[model samples]
Structure formats: structure tokens, C-alpha cells
Target chain A: METYIFYGIAIIALLVSFQKNRAKTRSALKKAWKSFENILPQLLTMVLLIGTLLVFADTALISKIVGKDSGWLGVLLAALIGSVTMIPPFVAFPTAAMLLRAGAGYMQIGAFVSTLMMVGVVTMPVEIQYFGKKLTFLRNLLAFVFSFAVAWVIQGVVG
Target chain B: MKKGKMILKRYRFALITMAAVGVLLLLQPQIGMKAIQNSTFQLQQMFFVIPPIFLLLGLLDVWVPKTTMVKYMGEGSGIKGILLSFLIGSAAAGPLYGAFPVAAVFMKKGIKFSNLMIFIGAWSTMKIPMFLFEMGSLGVKFALTRLAVDIPGILMIANTLQKMLTAKEVEEIYQKAETLLD
Candidate 1:
């Protein structure tokens, strides 16, 4: 799995760094912990918000909102839902396919998947901590608008 | 008491949400329990996925000189820098939020603004593992079409975002980054 690969690389790198200079390796670990702790507060809030959002926007409700023949309005709804909720791609893609099978249109799925990846309503607090307000706002807004274009293209090609 | 107050100040939002969850549990136990389970799953994923990323980031910070990073991803690195940004971003694992910390480091290292945006765009949508999952689940056409549009879109968005920022603002952001990850 990808997780193993990441851990593998990290551990090997850590060992090499340790062998080269103990002080440098220790500094690296210290830096890593500092960065992690820096974001922990926002991360916890984001996680809790995502959980609550997911509970309200379950599969059935999502499918109902974006079902086939739901039209452009459905695409909008799909994009909004995607923007607000944070689901891992491993879970999201399969759920999207299931939604498709459950009468969700290709355009709707396109918008959902696009915005789901690009826009992070819940993660904005953490994003603000790094990039500040204007950049984060513009990026998410541009991405949200771009999701519609993505939906249109997918509809033309795959729908 | 002062330390406790500082902790509360930092975690005010989380504490509010926890209190909200308590209210939800009282009103609708089933939904509250589901929310708790979902939050636990997310927390587990974060614990599993984040440590290694931070470790690698730390190593990157210590080992990779700023000049080296600037040489590859800095202002004049051009097409090569853009391509490298996309490659690094797409090859990465974990959620979009995970990419932000790495991005902070990249900014601190003096990566070009547009290249940084491209990296973020790639991390958000063009990840190879996610693309493969999309192909399997949604069909090759769906996956390819998204990629086809997304590649160009990423470039356009990055450029546009870079343009939208004033030079002074960009400098300020980079200056903020210099201290942020520390």
C-alpha cells in the first residue's frame, strides 16, 4: 500500500540522516513535531466538522439530490456537497460510482468528484494558517467554478 | 492556570464542536454515535498517514538546502520547474490538507509562486493513485476525461492565481512561510 511506501521511505531516510549526523537528524525530528503540533488544533476541528457533515449528507441523500434528470441544479448541489465534505478518494470514487449506478448523472458525478478534490471548505482554517485568507479564498472559488467546466467536459465526453 | 487557559484558547473551536456533539448525543444518540465513529476513523487515518509525511518533510527541511530547492523550483526554473512540481505533487500520497504543510516548506525554500500553485492543484486532483482508482471505478473514459481537462485547468488556474496576487502580497506570503513551519 502507499502508506507502507511512505513509511519505508521516511524510515530509510531517517536512518541515513542519523548515520550522517545525529544532531541534524534530531533537528529534523524536532522540526517535524513542531509543524505537526502547529496544526493540531485546526486539524482536530476540521476532522470533527467533516464527521458531522458526513453524517448529514449520507449516500441516500446525496444520490437523491444529484440523481439523473436532476439537471444543472443537481450538478450545483453535487458540487456544493463535494465542497463541504471531505472523503478520502479511495472511498469517494467507489461511492461516486455507486451514486452513478443509483441514477446519479455523469455530469453530477463529474461536478461532485471535481469539487470534492479541489475545494476544501472544512480544511480552510488550516489553509488560512499557511496561505492566508485571500489566496485560499481565490483558490477555492476558482476551483468551485472550474468544477462546472469539468462537469460540462465530462458530460460531453463520457455522459 | 495560565497554561490551561492557553490550551483552551488554542482549542476553542474543537471544544465547541465537542460540546455540540454532546448535545447531538443527547438529542439523537444514533446520529451522535455515527459521527463519533466517523471522527474516529478520520483520526486514525490522520495518525497513520501524517507521521511519515512530517518525517520526510523534516528531512527535506534539514537536508535539502534552500539554494537546491530554488535551483529546481525557483523563479527561473521555467517549464522544468512546472513539470517537477506536477510530478512531486501527483506522486504524493494523503489528503489535500497534508499537501499544505509541504507547500509551506516549498514556499520557505523560494519555489516560484505559479509552480507552488501548480503543485497544489496537482496534489488536489491529479494524484496518480487516485486517478487509477477513478479509472477502475468509473471507467477509463471518465478518468481520462477528467485528467485531460484537469491538466490544462491546473495550469490556467495556477497562472491566474499568481497574477491575482500583487508582488508585495506574494513577498509577504513567502515571508510568512519563512516563519510558519518553524
Candidate 2:
């Protein structure tokens, strides 16, 4: 079902892109390739980092930090770690799924995934380069706090 | 020295590739080969999947002119504009970086900074396609809960940031972009 939905959206997007006479599909493709090229180094680094983390970090290690019984301290710690770690959302979801299967709590997964996407401690340098330092810091700080709020809300709703 | 410079320029790509290999080997020689093989395969799959999507996105962006965007999302465009930007951004298919070019174009056309923040925040955090994926993998309740929490969180953060910066400051930034473009 999910695969079907994804393909459907992809098809629709392709059709939309092809609709207009002015659309420069070839140039757009070149630009997209260039974007990928620009990020290749960073992406390679991230893949290695994530691969290392998955290999070394086990359920026991994760549970010690974000186990269900660890309470708000665990939540805060998870949020902090997530804020500092930048993972693509596509990767983060499967990781959270794996952790959940390994006995991590919903709240912890929620906090981590939310912070992973929203907070940018790791990407702060890049973000600051793009958006000024002050704005970047404030955004990351607020996002870190809000990630915890998201976890708390999820706990309330799901628990 | 001129010959050296030419070689350096030509071999830059090879140098980076060799450095990446060296670092991987140095870190964990035992697993490095296996890791590289796996990562390469994964990267190949990602490239095949992601590039076309990004191309489609870029083409859609070009097709939808700046005038159309600004008409709906410009300064004092109000709640309607904010909502429209949010919906468009959340539905748009691509990474957060993809939003930058679109937002830059909108900013050039007088879209408010606060709303751009909202658009970007929601673009990354509140993607509907991502939500559907989550729903299928997780559950509808979980997806809905996340959507509920994230929507307001994105807005509130953007609003707070807006309060921190003055309208004049934002206008100044936009003017700078315009000047640079000119």
C-alpha cells in the first residue's frame, strides 16, 4: 500500500513537471545532479557515521539512555543527542523503528526523531553560514525545547 | 609550478576519493571494505531514486512562476498567504534545501520573512507525504498526533523569531538580496 502511494505521488509529480511548455526538464535534471554533487561529500560522511553508529550502538546502549523507565531525564538526554545528531528523515524513521523493536519507548523515539529533523546542533555551522549565527542558535534552541514538548504530547496522546 | 597546478586541478576529484578511502580504512580496517561496499550500493540506489524526484521538483518550481507565488504569498498576504505557503511547502516533494531556492525567489518578490520561516519549518517538519509513510509504518493515531503537535510548534517558533527581529531588518535583508541580484 505504501509503495503504491509513493509511486502514485511520483507519477503525479512527473506529470506535473511535464505539463508546461516552458518547463526545462533537461536543465532541471542538470541542476538536480549539481545539487547532489555539491552535497556528495557531506552525504558520504553521514552515511559512514550512521553505519558506524548502527554497528556499535546496541539496544542496551540505547536503552540505558532512553528506556521507558528512565523518565524525563532520559527524554531530555535523548532530545539533546538528537538535536546534535543530524539524520535525514527517511533514515531517521527506519532507525526509530529499529530502536522501537529493540525495546525503546515511543516517547524516546518521538523525541529523538522530532529533534533529529527539527534541531540542528550538528548542522549548526552550516546553518549559521546560511542563516546568521544568532538566528541559527535561536532556532535550534527553540526547536530542541519544542521537540521535548512533542515527546510529552505524544506520550499523553499515545500512553 | 604551472604543470603542478594543472595536475592538482585535474586530480582534485581523485585526491578527495582517495582521502575518503584512506579515512575509512584508517578508522576500521577490518570492516572498512564491507562498509564501503554496502554504502556504495545504498548510495547507488539513493541516487537513482532521488535525482529524478529533485528534477521534477525543480521543473515544477520553474513552471510555477514567481508572480503566481507572490500573488498568493507576498507581504501582508496575511493568514491566507501563510496557510497557502504552508500547504504548498508541506505538500511539495523534496528535501529542506529544495525550499531555499523557492523561498529565495519568494523573498525577492516581497514574501515576508516570518512567513518564509513558517514555510521552511513546515516544509521540513510537516510533509504530508512523509506523514502518510509514517501512518503506514506506524499508525494513523501516531501520525495525527505528530501533525497536531508540529503544525502549531512550527508557527509559534516562526512567530517568536519574527518578534525577535524587526520588520525593517528583514526588509533590509531582502533589499540586500535584490541589490546583489541586480
Candidate 3:
């Protein structure tokens, strides 16, 4: 999978760098660990927040919220759920399929999926740690708003 | 002892949150248990994706010169920068939050702000593996439709944000990134 490819590239690059200059390779590893450790505290907290949020936004509740024929209400609920929650896309798509089967509208699912990818309410603190408050806020706000367009387009083309 | 204190200071928010979660467990056992499971699940994903990214980022930091990044993705790097930004982002494998650190590194390396935003956009929505999965779960038509809409939206967002942030703001962000890497 993609993980395998990333591991392969990283190992190969590490080997090449080692052969070229051991010190440089060592420094690279150190730098990597430092940066990761610097963010670890925030990252851990974000994961916990996502966990709590996901518990409330579980699939059954989501399907209920965005039921078919719910129209804009469903889209709004879906977008709000997607914005707040942080489910992995791998799990999310299958769950989306299940929601669709359970009578959720495509427009709602579209909003949910798009916002799920683009907006990260729970991860805002970690984002702010790296991106600064202004840019992070602006970026997520923009993504959240644009997700409705994504929903509309998908509904038009596929739903 | 000092380092331990520093670590605790840095992790104060996490500690408070964990304490709150414990309180939730006492108050609502069912939801609390589920939340714990969900948190562990997220932790699993984070471990799988985070290490290699930081490793690659580290390598990128040491090996790639700022000049090289600028030549390709900096101001006036133009269409090539845009394409490269998209490719780097689309090929990525982690959550959008993961992209922020990479974006920080990009800023340190002098990548153009717009290209950096494009990279973030690509990471957020156009990820290739995620796209394939979306196709499988949501149908190819829905997946493709989102991708088509997203491409333009990504560009518009990056440009709009670029316009919104003043030159001083952008410089300050880059400076913040530089210090962060150090």
C-alpha cells in the first residue's frame, strides 16, 4: 500500500544519505525526531479530542441525522458532523456507503465526506501550533464553506 | 527534574484533557469506554503514518537546499511549482494535520505561500489512495465529481488566502516556521 511505498522511499533515501555522509544522515534522523517530539504533545491531545468527538458522531447517529429527504437540514448536519469529527477516510468511506444504504442522501454524504477531508475542528490546536492562528482559522473556515459546493456538485453529477 | 517539568508544562493541556476524559468515564461509562477505544484507534493510525513522514521531512530538510525548493516552488516558480505542489500533496498518505508540519518545513525552505497552500489542499482532498477508496465506496462518479470540483476550489482557496494575508503576515509565518525548525 502507500505505507509500503513511503517506507521504501525513506529507507532507500536513508541508505543513500548514509553512504554519502553518515553525519548528515544522522542529523536528518535527529531533526526528524526533534520535530516529531515537538509536536507530540499537541498531536496526542488532538487524537483524544477526535476520539471523544467520534464517540458522539458514531455512524448510526450520523445516518439518523442526515437521513434521506432531509434536504438542506441533512446537508447542514452532515457538514457539521464532518467538520467536528476526525475519522480516517478508510473507515469513513465504507461508513458513508453504509449510511447511503441506510437511507442517507448523497448530498449529505457529499458534504460529510468533503468536510471530513478538508476541515479539522478537533485538530485546530495542532494546526495552530504549526500554521499560526490566523492562517489556520482562515484555512479551515474556507474549507468548511467550500465543502457545500462539493456537496452540490456531487449531488448534481452523481446523486 | 527540570526537563520533566518542561515536558509536563508542554503537556498541560493533554493532562487536563485526559483528566476530563477520566471524569467522563466516571460520569458516563458507556460513552467513555467507546471514546477510549476510538482514541486508541486514532493512535494506531497516527503511529502508522507519522514516523515515515517525519523521517522524509528530516531528510528533505538536510538534503534539499532552500534554493532548490525556491527554484521550483517559490515565488514566480509558476506552473511547475503548482504542479509539483499538487503532486507532493496528492501522493501524501497522512491526515491533513500531518500536512501542516510539512508545510512548515516548506515555509522554512522558502516555498511560495500559494504553492504551500496547494500542497495542503492536495493533502486534504485530492490524495490518490483516498480517491481510489472514495471511488470504491461512493462510486466512481461521485469520487470523480468531487475531484473535479476540488481542483479549482483548491486553487481558488490558495490564491484567495494568499491575497488575504499581507506581506508582513506571510513573512512572520515564515519566521515562525524557521524558529520552529530550529
For each candidate, the alpha-carbon lDDT, in order, equals 0.85, 0.68, 0.83
Q: Model 2 segments beyond 4 Å from truth?
A: A8-56, A129-131, B1-67, B136-139, B179-182
Model 3: residue B3 alpha-carbon error in angstroms: 26
* DockQ of every candidate: 0.46, 0.34, 0.44
Q: Candidate 1: where is the Cα deviation over 4 Å? A: A1-64, B1-70
lDDT of 1 at A154: 96
Q: For model 1, how does the per-residue alpha-carbon lDDT over B1-182 read when each residue is reduced to its tens digit?
A: 99999999999988999899889989999999988987787677657756776787777768765344445998899899999899778866568999998898899788999999999999999987577657756878999999999999999999899899999988988889889877
Q: Estimate each model's TM-score.
A: 0.65, 0.69, 0.65
What tens digits encode model 1's per-residue C-alpha lDDT throughout A4-28?
A: 7778888999999999999999999
Residue A131 in model 3: shift from native, Å? 1.5
- Least well predicted 10-residue stretch by lDDT in candidate 1 chain A: A94-103
Per-residue lDDT for B1-182 in model 3, tens only? 99999999999988988998899999999999988987786567556755666677777768765334445888888899999899788867668888887888899878899999999999999987577657656777888999999999999999999998999999999999888887
Query: Which residue pairs overlap in candidate 2's backbone?
Result: none
Best by DockQ: 1
Candidate 1 backbone collisions, by pair: none
